[model samples]
Target: MTASAGVLDELDGIRWRERGSCAADPDGGWFEDLRAPAARRARSICAGCPVRRKCLAAALLYGEEFGIWGGLDSDQRHPLDEALRHGEPLGRVVDCALRADRAA
Candidate 1:
């Protein structure tokens, strides 16, 4: 795990239910509202989050196909996921993140 793995992996171990794992709302299609309403809420509560980078990297490294894989929501992160899952080069994905980060 990296220094910024996030809440999923914590002081003792993985807290899957409370962290990163998703909830399905019957009519809503997907996702349970586990995060704060604003991005700052996430960045504040999760900035020094032990698994922050790891969470983001996992979304990039593996083509996780649902929910908020990293701290980012689906729309915020789908491009990188698509690129990796389609066998696109890792560098392409990295570049995309860089470009996206700037836009953010």
Candidate 2:
């Protein structure tokens, strides 16, 4: 999905989280667990999430160093975080990561 201005604006707070695919799941640990199986499950859920870009943007913006956000774990998001720190636009970086995710 394109990161429109309205969507970007919504990323300012925790409100966007309500729409995440993982929001309703009782076991929130799947996203934060270092175990491979849990991470796989989290990524699978993130794959179909409608607010993935928002999720990733928020994660990067807030320096979330743990958990799977927008289908990407900490390791996958590290470079993108570095890019953001280097002055890359948050939207652009998120879009690139999502594109690469789809291609993979």
Candidate 3:
């Protein structure tokens, strides 16, 4: 489903919503960097987060423009959010990401 701003509240009943690994991180400071090393560390944390998918969905749904969510940096999330906003199918966005990854 396409996501919109403040949609995370609708997921309150989802257990992962309360189980994000970064919940206790000091304002999620570690996720703000665009540097490769910092991004790697942040992604490592997200990789272990139970709520990784939810966090990513929330970010994409809301057009979050900062920090790492669901193992993705803001740059990685941009096209996904754009696709969702434009009513593109989710699979198309995934395929685009895969193509970009392969190209890189």
Candidate 4:
């Protein structure tokens, strides 16, 4: 662990909305009304993750968006920007990015 179990403990907060509870969202995701804001908030939650660096690396490799992955998310970091900054490929966390303009 990079810091402590407490880091990831905050990750549970990422699931603010139930998977299939939202009637508006096809996926029934939580915080469907504020997806952009949710991503940022989730990044804050990631700041406490113990394996933040590793998680970020994994996210970068996978291209994970939304939620707190590696102390960041689609709202806090762009896919290409992440790859350029870390000089690595993100095909593991996210296969592709949904929005690049809103990237941090």
List TM-score per model, in order.
0.42, 0.83, 0.63, 0.36
Candidate 1 whole-model C-alpha lDDT, 0 to 1: 0.49
Candidate 2 lDDT, tens digit per residue, 18-52?
88898998485555566767677778888999989
Count of clashing residue pairs in every prediction: 9, 0, 0, 15
Candidate 2: give its CA RMSD in angstroms: 3.5
**Which residue pairs in candidate 3 collide?**
none
Ranking by lDDT: 2, 3, 1, 4
Off by over 4 Å in 2: 1-9, 32-35
Error of 1 at 62 (Å): 5.5
Best by lDDT: 2
Candidate 1 structure quality by residue, lDDT tens digits, 1-104: 75435322432333432453222212231344545354434433333344444456665655556644445556767777677678876555655664466466
Q: How accurate locally is residue 92 in candidate 2, as Cα lDDT from 0 to 100?
A: 93
The local distance difference test score of each candidate is 0.49, 0.84, 0.66, 0.43
Query: 1 or 4, which is superior by TM-score?
Result: 1
Model 4 stretches astray by more than 4 angstroms: 1-41, 79-104
Off by over 4 Å in 1: 1-40, 60-67, 89-99
